[model samples]
Target chain A: MNITDLDTPTLAADLDVLERNIDGMAQHCQQLGIPLRVHTKTHKVPEIAKLQIDAGSQGITCQKLGEAEVMVDADVDDILIPYNIVGKPKLKRLTALVQRARITVALDSEETAIGISQQAIADGCVVPVIVELDTGSGRCGVQSPQAAQRLAQQIMKMQGIDFQGIMTYPSNVRAKPFIEETLNLLSSDGIPVNIISGGGTGSEAASKEIGCTETRSGSYVYEGMTRVGNSEMLTPERCVLRVIVTVVSTPTPERIIIDGGMKTFTSYPPTPYGHIIEHPDAKIYGMSVEHGHVDVSECSHRFKVGEQLSVIPLHQGMTSNLHDKLVGIRGDQVETTWQIAGRGKVF
Target chain B: MNITDLDTPTLAADLDVLERNIDGMAQHCQQLGIPLRVHTKTHKVPEIAKLQIDAGSQGITCQKLGEAEVMVDADVDDILIPYNIVGKPKLKRLTALVQRARITVALDSEETAIGISQQAIADGCVVPVIVELDTGSGRCGVQSPQAAQRLAQQIMKMQGIDFQGIMTYPSNVRAKPFIEETLNLLSSDGIPVNIISGGGTGSEAASKEIGCTETRSGSYVYEGMTRVGNSEMLTPERCVLRVIVTVVSTPTPERIIIDGGMKTFTSYPPTPYGHIIEHPDAKIYGMSVEHGHVDVSECSHRFKVGEQLSVIPLHQGMTSNLHDKLVGIRGDQVETTWQIAGRGKVF
Candidate 1:
């Protein structure tokens, strides 16, 4: 099937562009001598994760254990879950996943480490875990170097647990000194740090400078509009993922409605959920549950009903979670269809 | 199964509250002498749609043909789709849906009417369509009464098409005059306007005053935080849908991270994505893909790791679409698990 034959408000991935993005980031990380650990949270498709692994990624990183389970089912053996697995139910699932694959989790607190240790001991397996440092994102992770050392020390002392260094997201330039100091403190304490994984697509190029032995970049495979606007390496042309939407109504000269809306795209931040690839001037000012309201007063081009428009999502990861499958395209033809196996596996 | 046994960051529906909410709205519409057609977009489960139908809804309303298809498979014969179906592919699907169920579509433009008419003509079936009026929602529909009349005239003149009056969303107080004027204009033109359907959960009580024959309210079945905040009939206690999230980290005195975030909750509008049932002062200020960053400085309750929090989403429809199933709870026990059959069928 061709691009025009598919129904409206569906996600399409440009295979040519996707391959280029994958190879480009992989080669860049290889050249920098920083092992790339592609994050599966962005695409959530096992095929894409396998492609990333084959393209020279050291391992895959999943934000949730449910996602890690999906990757394991897809034959991906090495996975890192960079989030705390709380509660017995989740840790039980995490233990099963660890039994199937070489899984490592990131914990920021002693309580979480103890919980994982208890589950791992019951399962008769040693689960490797990394300390998540706050660095700068201010989301999750240990705030200070002392806290990191304390957490690492707790993990090392716990039975059925292996402390495997530290990791941070967005490995910003500001995190360098803190990571170095933490490494020095650990070294002084006679603790071996195997993995110092730090990276986001935004900071992948500077991962080495940020003292990261391995980098984890997810959005690099399917460059979103935000990345396109922020990253010097990414352009709109390089964005592999696009939501193909059709103009359903032009209620007024200024207002136009598309088939895709908040349900189709992520409603998160930076006004206008997506960028219209065909009309740069038209701004998607608002969105309802099923309607994307675009203001086309500035655009000279007139939009007729039934006309299809490709939109690059502002955040590709969140947008991909809303879709069931990704239509892989190569030169206006659908090359393959990959199911988003981990789409709603938020647990 | 029980609520506590389920994994974290999952959607749960309080069955008692759900039944009460469904019956309350149905009885309210019955008392108002307005036919209640529950929109299935809120909780896209066919089982819940069936429950709404059994609770006295005249029919079910779907936003897309794909959703209608799911409803049809579940044996819902009467369905109304309140959106313009453009393009041949979607039209083909709509025609197939029309064969199995009594389907009505909404249109505001001649281009869309012609496309539906041509498809209906090819199928040798007369498809009923309603002219959608703007009425101040500013999302979809004709801007003025004249535009609504023109679209009605075009649909009336078309072959294999039945003009089924008009409909508008959020049946605002200001839309009363426009709806009455459009109905008068159509009646004066000797066109029989059978159904003047107008309603959303926000405007369901006022639907009769707004001159609506039938009211369509989706979120009433599982009222969201927005509806609970706006509607006098709804309270937070009546909201059936709650996202069960676990507190994964307490990074600082003020900041706490939950297992749910933008992936689990709707990021649209009104700040804080959800309301914590136990702690009203704790605000979910920001969210990443899988982590909800909450500020709990004001709350006196201490949150330990693995503590479960039930959050009522600001927008339940968007949040429901992110999950595969809704854990139906009846007094802390999971009585049933209903698959969200129409979850990602956005096409």
Candidate 2:
């Protein structure tokens, strides 16, 4: 059945804008001689990843092992896992992933590195490992370049592990200065920074400016509110991804309700996520499951009760995780629909 | 894999607490002689719904069609869709569900009632629907008794639709008075109100005291902070769900981070979501993707990196939505592992 004809509220993508977004990011990175390793966690679909790779993404970056499995199954080669794979189940999964394709996993501590090393040795496989360096987004990674080198030295001594790179996800513009300082520290310490993988859609350009070889720009391919704010170069991201909703009730002239809420679009606070494409003035006030309350009080008397609206969400990455399928469209025409392969894959 | 033995920072559930919580709610409703229709939207697993029914719930209520589908697949006899289901696809799905079991849907507006009526007519099915009256909670439902009556009249006239009942989700004790007054209006109009479904975990006793025939309480089955504040009768709610997480980093001497964040827990704000079972003073300040930062900056240095702590979440319903599997344990011993059958079910 056609998505527009379906009886549910959804986020529909505009293809013309989406192609421009994908091609625009690739052209910018190619002009700067940086390999675009689009993060699969954003779209989390192999088709979109394939489109990015076909457009010149050197490879794909996965945040979870389950996501990596999706990318591998989609037949996309070169995968970079930027998460510290903790425990035996994940290690076994990571080691097996290395056997199928060229997999590079991140590590910030000797304990996790030792675990990864042990798994690689047991599998009789040489898995490439990168020491995650903390630049700014102080979520994970070693604090200093000295720590990175120390971890790398330990990995070099360990059997069946290749210390291939130094990676860091910086806090936006700090990608340039922070990475430069770290690169200088590593070189001075006689540590080889072969991969130098750092950069998200927010900091992709800055990382390239500072001599990083690869940039992971996942949201750019689909173009969420964050990516739209970060990249002024890309045309307003229009892809086939949108939340399609029909107005169910108008309790008052100001308060109209739609059948899409927090369940459809996870939490993107301060600004009620997903822009109403049909009604520019209509702002989504709050959402519960099966209902999105739009404060059309400003545009009161303008909205009809049964009108359907398409929304551009504030955060596209997490919203994609909420659904099982994406109805890919070309312009106003429905082209294809793909299951969000490996969706809800918490493991 | 054994949940406790697993290496990753995980969210472990306590079965001992779960069973006690189930029995507590069942007994509370039984004492009042009110039908306990547990909202499966909180748990989303059919196994839990079955357990709730087995514990003495009259039926199960689902927020979405997808959730209802999961329950129906698990052979849940009676299901209530508390939200207005729109669109041709969803309506068709709802019609198909009637063949399997008893289904009652909620409707707030005449337009939605018409849409459902049209779909039900097309499928040659007479679906029972309840007019959602707004007692409080300012979300979905008809505001005034006059509006409720008009909608009821429209529903009665609509083809292939039966206006069997009137329902409301009351926000507080004020709802008791408000709903009782409204039901009087409906009865005076000679409207047959078979099921006067009102009350949530927040207004359970007031719902019964105010004369609602059926009270829908979901969170009380696995009670959390929201229900705990509203209903004092549920004490063992603390025992059902526990988020088990491992400390990943100690960024500073004062701040410690756990490896479960927005991915493991829904980012519903207000306060730190859960109480750290191991650490009393520690409060979850905020969370990124893989790290939940706990601030213990003021007092002691009790917890180091890699320590495991189980947290009792402030909101158990949404917390259950984030995980793929439910690890049911009885006094640290896992009894059964059930798939979150309706995990990302956004229909």
Candidate 2 residue-wise lDDT, B40-113, digit = tens: 87778888888888998889898888888888888897988887877667878988897688999988888778
In the range A1-347, model 2's lDDT, one tens digit per residue, is 45567555655566677678888989998887888888887778888888888898889898777888888987988999887776667778888988999899887877777778888889998878887877777567777766766777788789978888878785255555656776676677676768988677767677777677787777776776665563222223454367878777777777888878877887657565667766767888888755788898778446655676787776776777777778766655677778888565555
Best by TM-score: 1
Q: Which stretches of candidate 2 lie over 4 Å from their true place?
A: A1-3, A171-191, A229-240, A300-306, B7-11, B171-173, B176-184, B228-239, B248-257, B271-273, B295-307
What C-alpha lDDT, on a 0 to 100 scale, does residue B270 get in candidate 1? 69
Q: For candidate 1 chain A, which ten residues in a row score worst on lDDT?
A: A227-236
DockQ for each of the predicted structures, in order? 0.73, 0.49
> Could you give the CAPRI-style class of model 1?
medium
Instruction: Report candidate 1's fraction of native contacts.
Output: 0.83
Worst 10 residues of 1 chain B by lDDT: B227-236
